[model samples]
Target: MKYLVMVQGTQADYEAMRGKASPGSPAWSEQEVQAMYAYMSAINDDLSETGEMIDGQGLAEPAHTRTVTLGDDGKAVITDGPYSETKELMAGYWLLECESLERVTEIADRITRCPQPEGAPNYPVVIRPVMEGAGDI
Candidate 1:
């Protein structure tokens, strides 16, 4: 079966880290950023080599989000999106072709232990299994 592990983070928590400093200031120091990038990159490479990486990427800040609504009349309405409104925003995701839910959970556990860069705030990465249908193949 194929599964998607959704990485989620709370808006308040995200803001706490995202709004840490001046516009030009780096959220994390150079060394911290490098550690973080290296850690995540290693995971990405491993997944790719194992054929478990369907797609994955970090998103830009929520400030650029936009919302759209539609009515029964089929007319469309657009509005600004408050990306932080939800309890958690999906930060990143990975698609895995695994043998069972247990296997997926094992992978999720490994992902959960992703090291935080030195001096960086700790964040939880939420994991969810993708829904499957009869047509799934």
Candidate 2:
């Protein structure tokens, strides 16, 4: 099964993360950051060892996004973004090809437990299994 692990959040929640959540910050409490890093690293290592990890990446802030839309003339319209609704923003994602849905769920649980950088508290990671030719399953 293939899965897309989405990191979703609100604009306000993200602004608060700009500090501790920013790249190369020592702002995260040492213990908390260490624990989460260890957990994430372990998850990655385990998945790689099992040949379940296909590809993955951490994203830059949503503020860097650009939107492309079709205009009446059929030309592409480009614009700066926070994208669609600022109330719900997609931060980042992971693509995994696993053996079973159960395994995917296990990975999702670990990701969801990742410590949010200070102000972004209790943020949840959502998992969606990809449907190939079908619309929805």
Question: Alpha-carbon error at 132 in model 2, in Å?
Answer: 4.0
TM-score of each: 0.70, 0.71
Residue pairs clashing, model 2: none
Per-candidate local distance difference test: 0.64, 0.69
Off by over 4 Å in 1: 10-27, 71-74, 117-124, 135-137
Supply the global lDDT for candidate 1.
Answer: 0.64
lDDT of 2: 0.69
